[model samples]
Target: MTTPTSSTVLVPRIRGALAHSDRIVLPQSVLEQLLSEAGRESLPSPLTFRVFNPATNAYTHCGVREFSAPESTVLISPQIASTLGVSEKQLQASSTQDGSTPPVLLVSKCDLPKGTFVSLCPLDTNYLTMDDNWKALLESALQASYTTLTEGQTFSIVNPATREAITLLVNNLQPEKAVCIVETDLTVDITAMSEDHAWKSVAHRDAKRKVESGKVATISQDAPVRGTFSDLSQVFLFDLKSWDRSRPVIVELEVLDAGDSSERDIDGRAADVFVSIDEHPSKDYFLWSTQTDEKNVISIAPSNSFLATAEKITLAVRSCVVPLSFSLMVSQEEGIVEQKSAPAPQSESRQCPNCKQLFPPRTFQLHTAFCERNNLLCPHLGCGRIFRRQDGIPASHWHCDLDSFSCDSVSTKEKHILAHHTLATCVCGESFPSQQHLAHHRATICPQKLHICRFCHLRLPQESRDSQSDLLAGYTGHEFRCGTRTTDCPRCNRIVKLRDLDSHMQLHELQRVSAPLPRICANALCVRVIDDDPAAANSNSLGLCSSCFGPLYSPMHDPTGARLKGRIERRYFIQLTTGCKRSYCTNPACVTGRTNSNLPKLAPAEVAAMVKELTEGGKLEFCVDDGMTRRRRLVNWIGDDNEFARPWICRAVGEVRVGGEDDDPTSSEAKARSWLVENGVRITEVR
Candidate 1:
């Protein structure tokens, strides 16, 4: 909403001297100056107007108005007059309207500058109604006008022809209703308004003075003065323009002391007084007071309707300040200090078994069980005995002696009890009452089936189905031999079993190689001759054969017949000394002739050959001491030696005869000689 600018008017400027003290006082000149300034200034001219009717107490709208020289007037149109229920003759007949029915004038103007007086002159009397609606309208209008006047910008009107100016100073206006016109000189700018604005400060100062002097200062001529109702917690309704002190307009609220009875004052004194007010009906407003103060005040708006309904404003009073004497007395009666508890009793001391150190009685008991299980004994080695816990049992109860033969004599019943009554049964359909009985029966009483090797008499399981039986059976016959490729048995004319072949060869008698023969004896003394089995006449024979005088010479022998001679010697020794009737060499290297002679010589060739012959013939025998019989025999021999022979040997072997004294020394020699003569007739030899 832009403010409209009024039409400009023309005026003259006159400069003249006045008769009083050289001051410019020309009436016509001053009038001309005013007119010129007014002409240059564009003022607000009303587009519509209102006139108040006193008799009816209502506002009627009049027609549009424009600014005129020496007067601000409204041009009342016939339509406007008819609409307002008034005649144009009445409006034209009056230069100024009656106070009861004044007209509202509007002018088109920019926002006024600070301190500029801008009046809404000829205001309608209908605006004075105390009705709520009228009051609200009046308030709104006042606020709006005030806002317009206080706008920061300044406005000026100038006449283009004469260059005369009018600077408007209209930025001062109260926000409330204007009951009277105020006139003041332009002083300060509107843009710099503060809380202490000039008009408000003056008002506050004037109000304060009025209050101190016991006079009721009204905020406005039409509103009532607000009075404090601290006498009690009550509400008050006030007219801001009048200074009327009337009865409260709202419901009375109960007042009560709010402070605690035992609370202390700032100086550490007991409190006996307090102040309080009841909860207000409107939660936005409340009453409050300090404990030290005995009065209460209710918070309410001057214009609130409920304030007028209060019957009385009563301030509940109680002593809030505490007495110092009362505080000291209470302290004396209650006793201010606290008491502490006494310490607990200490336990007695005792010795620890593990470390042999003293410890508290309770500690020893707690650790003794653990110490006993670990076998800690007294530190003194001479007495290194384990400490028994103090249970009421004899030392024998836990004896560890193992020398007693009692364990051997424990009965079968005891054994059964110890073995948890477990019984044993044999595969042969025999059963025993306990494990001990079963063990004894299996070891001694049971008829165990046995398989014996015919040659070695070694026991074997009856269930064995291997060729061991055949091997054993073959060994008992004269014609049997192991089928192994080499080392055949001479007497039986068969190969020995694989395992016995090497040992059997070591005992062969016939021309057997004593030490393995060299391939061709590097010593040039050994002879090589392979045996031909006469029993194998069906097979090819290339090597030499045995004869009475020498080897039956094979065509394959050495041309010089040296090997034949060696063969004859070997055969002779084997037959004559070994008493072997067989004719085959059983040595492995002799059969293959791959031996090295650097190794040590073995047993004599004749003995080896005889042994071999006996073994092959199934006639070899040995005497092995049976473990039970030999042990018994050894025990008897040892006992006899210890009883008789050892004593005799000890006496006879170490005894020494000492010679007699001088007189009998020659006699001793003569006796020795006599003894030699008696025993062997060697008396001359001794001489």
Candidate 2:
């Protein structure tokens, strides 16, 4: 597929939609996509619509609707509105800022042939209530489709009666969300990550960049901006005020919290740093884009520098999806540098006698390491490789050619290298950066891009393109997935525009259930094309193969399918049918084992059964891994020999529970107190 541009799209997911109508309504964008795949050909008898949720890797089939679902919404009844006490009337009904009216809690009652049904009840009245501040936060979160807040984690809300955050945890926020509760142990902490990596608001930009009435005019120096994979939240806008338009500009980069450059360092840590300069008015257009390595200081020389441009530079970073970014604006007035100078160098100061400059606090440690004038000799004893303090400062990533200038301090040596290093020029008479940068220039953005995409009619300006055929590989693989592009044929010497390939080829990915192109059922023995073949979609097939249809794994139709499907008789046939389907579950005892892999593609119910057998029947050994919950067992599971499970788990309620729990812990109060003290928890009370 052609690279999808970075974007945040809001796709509405409706719950309780079936509560009001037989047909499922959806936004125009979603409907168009659905029609493109599922609703393509002739409408089937007793039409069905299937939707696959990639997040859960599951599909939902609904009864079809002939007319379009209008206005990017699913409307519930006014009575429902009264029931919910929420109205999206003020939310513009936009795809982004819309939400469900409210939530109705459900309880299960197992009193049917098929099984238990989860129906709403008056006693299941624990919905949600929030104050104005919380309401805004929740609204914003829902708009962004935040996983934690919208997924029914117990969010402590301000109690209207007591004005205190309540500790009531809510559950089952699916399809749509409109309820909340206080956080609990079961409430998954979606924000699980290391200190360096957490989804959080890190930095703030000058609001004036977009809105004139923006409160902040400049990026907060104190704040560190954070970005994501798609959004470059941190962009440092730098204005080149140099009078000479043709002259190149130098850009400096500083890594914050880039651990100690002193004795120990975190320089080896992997970081994806993007440094791109805005070249043209077109948003995605870029004049220059390159990445940096190492955490130490470095300066980049870039051409095509402009003056007073609204948007200029950007600094976005990523450690995969967890992204971080920071913005900076550089402005310099003519002769302004001379006016805002520091005090003259003093002999008593950390400033070396020869360098005649003051060191920023961050660099003082490194600067003092090799400054011979201040008598701070290299830590490497007897290696009298010293230089005038003048040759050191602003550690640059340059290496010295001379072997004599070997200072033990890395920063000091780096400075000397830059001072003594010579610039290399390209064949085009353009001065190139150091060797590595020159190599990178040769690879990407090398003015003379030869290999071109025949489809996109675009030049491949990346590294190392061998022959025309090698470049064609990229065009065919990367450029020609879905869109239209202009391609030039090498052998035929002909240029033609390519049409959108998705129009004809997208049926293979059809997820929704409706009438469309022919497709063989996933079953190996069953070669049924339910859409194209009329007989395939009949009641006999149940719109699926005999084996698949027999499973009838729709939770919508059967609420207690697990208990029903797990019966011994059903299990034998189900395994036999699935065994032929694939290498999943080939236990000869259950079904005719086929294929060597013998992978068990257990259905949800089957998994629950296996787990039950393992735990209850003691079919497997259990230690820390709980046989039932699969979670680490409680500390009482801890023995005198079990060092790992003996420690008290800090419960959110502030109760310390071991495997023995609160009461059993008093029996081993001495042991518990000793353990607590060893772990640095003050032993306030043992009994």
User: How far is 49's C-alpha from truth in model 1 (Å)?
Assistant: 99
What's the C-alpha lDDT at position 491 in model 1? 45
Best by lDDT: 2
Give the per-residue Cα lDDT of candidate 2 at 125.
15
Worst ten in a row by lDDT for model 1: 17-26
| lDDT (C-alpha, whole model) for all candidates | 0.30, 0.33
Off by over 4 Å in 2: 1-59, 62-245, 252-274, 278-311, 315-482, 485-687
TM-scores of all predicted structures = 0.13, 0.21
Off by over 4 Å in 1: 1-687
lDDT of 1 by residue, 414-479 (tens): 322422245667544677664445534433233332223333333321222234653454332211
State in Å the error of residue 598, model 1.
34
Give each model's clash number.
47, 14
- Count of clashing pairs, candidate 2: 14
